[model samples]
Target: MTQFEINSDISVARCLSPSFYLDDVYFESSRDHIFSRTWQFAGLKSDADNIRPVTLLEGFLDEPLIVTYDGELRCFSNVCTHRGNLLVSESCRGASIRCGYHGRKFDLSGKFLSMPEFEGVRDFPGPEDDLAGLEIREVAGLMFVAFDPAGSFEEFFGPTLGRLADFENSNTAVSTSVYEVNAHWALYCENYLEGFHIPYVHKSLNRELDFASYDIRTFRFSSLQTAVPAELEKDSGRRQEFDGKAAFYYFVFPNLMFNFYPWGLSVNVVEPLSPTRTRVRYVTLETDPSKRKTGAGSDLERVEAEDQRIVESVQKGIGSRLYKPGRYSVKQEIGTHHFHRLIAEFMNQGGAR
Candidate 1:
């Protein structure tokens, strides 16, 4: 067992124990309390365009979820009512979604349209037989879904989503270089919520950002890390120029990160695969093509590599017997403490499995 301690001297609380990261039972609980209850970025609004007002997004928290747009926007579980076959195998545009296996048809709203072979069955089109509906919400052009109907996107995102409202509505195109990284989802989130590791883990990034001037602010369920260049630190007047350096990082509750750079923006969605495995999906949003590669944020590949190396190392360290819950640096790690507190609160409420 690992020993844990909290430092009351600091303004912020310490992080959870190493067992929270390493224990399988704890991970299972988090899947429900944290992941299922929080809003998850499903895909872009443009994805629905390809399928012409209807697109199916697959693999949301290990469950298939479909998003459709006819006159209104809706999402439903992509599981068939009869025989439990997956409803939508691949994204397609059509009048209705029909299961390929049994030809059980469903309208855009997940209403039972018709079943080919069940003519003799009583109460065939009952409400219980209809597809399970999942809650869907959109911010700007990005779409999100929640398995728990009681969860509210506004409540889960809180001020983090509101802060980035302008950037979200900008005329930005999704970058082609969509990156998929393999790691524990929580580790990626932990790395994102703090700037404490920037100096040690990211040497090139440190050169571009003023480590001393980095500002971190905590909100209800999220946090922000703002970075300004060394030259611009003293001059608050020169903050909004296209070339002027600024990076606004927002971690929204459980597993979404919105990074706004002088160039444009990048959205990160963390998806857990198992207790020790996760997928980090990066979607870039930018209006100016030329500005995509500017500032310390330009070298995305290098920065991503630096982040991956440190986070994976931390994951390994947390599994060690010598490791325990660690204290937070009040000035540096308040965002991390905020995240841990939210996790504890949700778990205490029986949200965790």
Candidate 2:
């Protein structure tokens, strides 16, 4: 592990070594130490709707998991209980998950139901025969799961959840066009943590947001970046339309971003696909049913494309041999420092149980 002098000096809080971003060994270690223990946004509540016996959500952060709803919502290791065959092929509704390999069956709640070819084997169906259960939690319409049960979901996600309570209470339904982007997951997160690069990287976005009034504040394992128009600049002020209104970009530690606009919210869940690749799933939740197709929120596809271009370039740059760790602009990147520290803490704790 890379060691640093932890003191009052903001200069010491520069990003992790370039190796942390480039090395495969470091990436694998981070997956075990940090990602496994962290709470990951799995899917939206709408994804878990109806009487679907099995909902196969390809796991983020290297742990394969599936959420199911028969009578009760449950999360289980996607690896089958018998012979280690993967249970569900895709998202579909069924009475139970039947292993395609050997037809071993499991109920929606991950309880061992029955197996066809195990009649002669004594103690064939035991606890080991049941799908491994994972802790599942929900905030608003978002469903989250932690591979490690010992880690508290509330402790990890409380701040963002509290901030989102009011918007959730408005009962916003997810917009159908859920956009997905490819980039390094942490790159996406680091970008969202602060507005430092917005003016230079996001020309169109910079015009929309007031950079002078943009401020970032940190709360344990979470951070909020507030962007208000220069005209209506105050510590706190409200606007009618989302065009020049206050936008709160909330970064819940590890991988979730809740971007609050006047119209509604945009939830970005960053999922690491590989050492160098990632998928950002953007789910837009809108309360104003009629205004969904208009205003600032409507141009999501363009905004996402802009973000992808910049992040992908950064990903390529971080891998270069010439690159090393650099200083953080104390004025601009305190939130990013806080994020790196939290990541260090989680990783230093070692793997979760």
Candidate 3:
């Protein structure tokens, strides 16, 4: 077993070991030790459908789930209890969920309703006959589910929960896109944890923000990185809308980003496909149409392309035999350092909390 240790002091700490990214053993370990125990964005909430089926972290954890809304929203296993068959094929309104294989029935609340041709069986319907209900939390019009979360929802999202209040019922999704990157999922997230590469990788985005005043704040399970518009640096009066902030980037461990811009929110969900391949889903919601194409949020696809290029290059570099872990920049890489520490803490723990 390869153990990862990141120093507590930023000035003395180094990045996560290259083995953590390049080794299959570590990748497999994280599937249960890290991703399985953290909150993940299932999907955006919708009133149009009463029962929505979602596969949590498809291609990775691959846990099938169903989010049903009666008067309130709840999440349950999409698998049938009797024969382990899938219950819901798609999102639709129905009075009950019946297993196609055995006709084991479950109500919207995931309680066992009835089963056919089982009258003679003793102790047939018990606690295990009902669908397993999982823990779910709603934040900013997005639904997040966890099998066994290491911490409470408030501990994970408390620092920035108030910042997203206005978007609770108002996520007007304009577009959704998926980008495939031939790099480790953590590499993509590591690149996102800092603005140090913005000047070198994202020339267009670098021009929009004041790099000197870039701010980073880390919480127990989340971090915030704020960028100020270059124009706002000149005239501080116009920056009052969102405290003169051009972009509010919030990263919730282990793979969710809530990016708030003047125009709207872009929710980025990073899904690990394999040790070297990852899928990034971009959900673009427009909150202010007038502010579109104006600031740090504009031309997002181009920015993503630039990020992909550099991250892929790093993926290749880390595989070299002579390569070694590098030190972190105390001022510019706090978010990245915090993320590494959390990964180390979870990997070293005995089991999920």
Candidate 4:
């Protein structure tokens, strides 16, 4: 199997093969080749303040995990080794984790503790008996977990998180919405990669931004899309109070969006359910209540509804036999092109492109 190669030059690169979004085999292969090998959110760092069990990608990867704060916070497998039982079922501060099935015990750090009725057993305890600790990290008060992570946390999210360090602190009042949509996860992501559809599809949004000045900036594993407000472009002094005259839309590879506005940050996590089903979540953090309903970030629900409609339409359009590979609009679709390149790079692993 040869690795998938993307043409570095966007001028001639064709769009990703439609089969990448339509095939069940390709969808399943992505579980290991992509998702599992990448970092994922495991709720906020506050979830670890009190030991709690958190499920990673509940409807997909479905890994049972937990975070315990024993003076310091640490993440570990929620499963007990003695018998396959969930060790902290709910959120609570616990000195140690205990399995209800066999009364097997482990310390907060996932070290093996004494078990019942094993007095005379040979090779009483081994490394396998201890709970498995995962590769976990906390960035800007958000908890991130990964199984067989491909690289360091910085490698996965250096640009987006680093850019927010000066402006934000702990996440406060995070509003989350999770639901399934009838479309490939990648399809929904590509829709977000470019601002090209905003002027045509988002009527209310079009009034807020100066789409002519909108630009897509690419990073190592992420891309930034900046939108200058029409009013700010006309009067710069008017937006002097905000971070910048433009709204920042950042997309982290695979499935994460860090959208920053004058109000705060709106985080989107895309979880795939199947070849044509996906789970989308929105986590919003507001720093300034005054900026909630103004500028580019306002009317989020309306924009989302519009996006859902068009992306689902595209999902069906791509399935048509008459449809063939498309070309990228070099000026506006650079983000989508970068995404396709990464997708191809991963998909080609362990198989032919």
Candidate 5:
């Protein structure tokens, strides 16, 4: 029941309290307070079937959902209204959904179609019998759904749309990788919000990026960090078309990372399994095959290994009785500070809608 607050002034604002990461109470509460209210990565529209089942936020929210496309794509509760049975267990081509449990059925749009053996039932097949619908937003070829979003999809992703369109499209080669971390989700995210530790933690990455020109820009529900290629990379003519930029790392509030490199996009969706455990899914889209192994995006595996090592150590350190919340480096940690402030604001809100 504790409300967290972060100082607005980065000059004096301490990092988000360790309690936010260490306490079980906050972790459970965040399922609704933070995650549910934010837009979550659903899946690629290109990969969806006429009827596909998706579990929103997987281990976190775990809301069983069915994405259907008749003339248009839509989302609905995968649970049947009659007896709460699961409607669609997997992706299939169908004009309607039939609950294998009770033989109840609904159309692709989630409207109640028919209920077998309920011919004489009182108040039978009313609106309550219809499947519950949810809102979905499609960006590029990706799909996102929210149970109760705090803001519009545009507000959450608009800033990057213009630039994203150029690099992400149907032709991109998509792949997926997942890493389980023995650390709080916030630790991993905050680590990504700043480049301050690059020189200290990632020697190889540091060599490829111009640390001096690293820039962070904070938006309403997201933040962007641009890394300029090192002189050697620029001289190689690899980053010429990008006008000296090597990477575009984007963080959507709560837990979504859209990292754009010359090769393609790497999306990290942070899933909370427990207070001490987290799952980070890497959805990679290769736009330019020739550039896949070049620039800052090339050595992702090494950089990720290094990051996991450092963040896991911080996880252990924060649990120490002697440790306290630390202050932010105003010049280097604006993105991190902004993230902490958003966490405080969302966590302090009333119960989730």
Candidate 6:
């Protein structure tokens, strides 16, 4: 059944089915059912010097999309209305977008401006000739785009913006690293959703964090995982006032992770390549450059290596005939439970969007 139900009370709830991790049919269905309706990171407002065309979820959605600006920035389908040729093949600055194929032109804001050789066309330059615009929301320099979204921007990400109100100004570019992992996309996400494996999986990280005091707080479409540093680590007095000497990890709904440290913000985006493969992008925004050398955020490469290896191993193990769903560690699995419920609810919905 598509209705993969989970009990509201975590006390006796079973984990998500093994089939959800293995079947190609389910994997393909999730693209339209879940990802298409969710808000996705398009690019940063500060990312371009001019009008830029970007593909949404490149390998998966592969939707031709363009982000352009005149006085106002807009995100619209990048396909030419007359011939379906890509409108903007590269990042370039111009007052308007012109398809190289047939010279159909649109304003930078995506309004149909002119078309050559279409003088006799019926209903010429109607709304259909204009580039179709998607639902886009811009906040804190990040551009988010979604198609027939299941929820509003505020409903999906309001709490995150509220907590990170001070971060809006650090919209500058930073280091970005992308890693390809041989793991289920959800496996990478489930591992990131909770901190239960930190003590066992991340030895160096465990040293800086106080295990007993670490906590997970859940929201409507997101969850926050916070770890108070060990007393000696905190006593060093290098942290900023934000998060009050704790490292905050915010997991937004399905696949995005915002990791905050005194060093800055780390945006980890999990992109599905196939049912058993995933691409994880680590983007670092250094608000406080000096803090990069220490604490839970430091040595990210080492930590990422550790997380990736284990997740890949789980990817292999999940396909076993003997495999079965297990129980949740009620105290520590709050975020995973919330995630599973969302998967079920969203996936159960039809692929209309």
Best by lDDT: 3
> Which regions of candidate 1 deviate over 4 angstroms?
1-12, 47-60, 117-120, 149-151, 167-169, 176-183, 233-237, 242-245
Score candidate 6 by TM-score against the native. 0.94
lDDT of 5 by residue, 1-353 (tens): 77788999999888888899999999998888888888899988754478999998788789999998876889989999988989888789977888899788799999998877887798876898888899997777778898788888878775776666775444788899999999999899999999999999999989889999999999988999998888755376655566678888988887889998877788899888888899999988787889877778889999999999999999999999999888899889999999888889889983233
Q: Cα RMSD to native, each candidate?
A: 3.7, 3.9, 1.3, 2.4, 1.8, 2.1
lDDT of 6 by residue, 210-246 (tens): 8888899888778889988776453655444554555
Arrange candidates by lDDT, descending.
3, 5, 4, 6, 1, 2
Q: What TM-score fits each model?
A: 0.86, 0.82, 0.97, 0.94, 0.95, 0.94
Model 6 ranges off by over 4 Å = 171-173, 232-240, 350-353
Give the residue spans of candidate 3 off by over 4 A. Answer: 350-352
The collision pairs in model 6 are none
lDDT of 3 by residue, 213-260 (tens): 899999988999998898885776767877788899999998988899
List, residue by residue over 33-97, the lDDT tens digit for candidate 2.
77777777767654444323233224434456678775466788778776787776567777777
Q: Please report, in order, the local distance difference test score of every candidate based on alpha carbons.
A: 0.72, 0.70, 0.88, 0.83, 0.86, 0.82
Candidate 2's error at 8, in angstroms?
6.8
Query: What TM-score would candidate 2 get against the native?
Result: 0.82
Angstrom error of the Cα, residue 324, model 5: value is 1.1
Count clashing residue pairs in model 3. 1
Per-residue lDDT over 206-324 for candidate 1, one digit per residue giving the tens place of the 0 to 100 score: 88788887888876667788887766766766466643556778888888888877667788877676656666778887766676565666887898888887777777778888875
Best by TM-score: 3
- Candidate 5: clashing residue pairs, number: 0
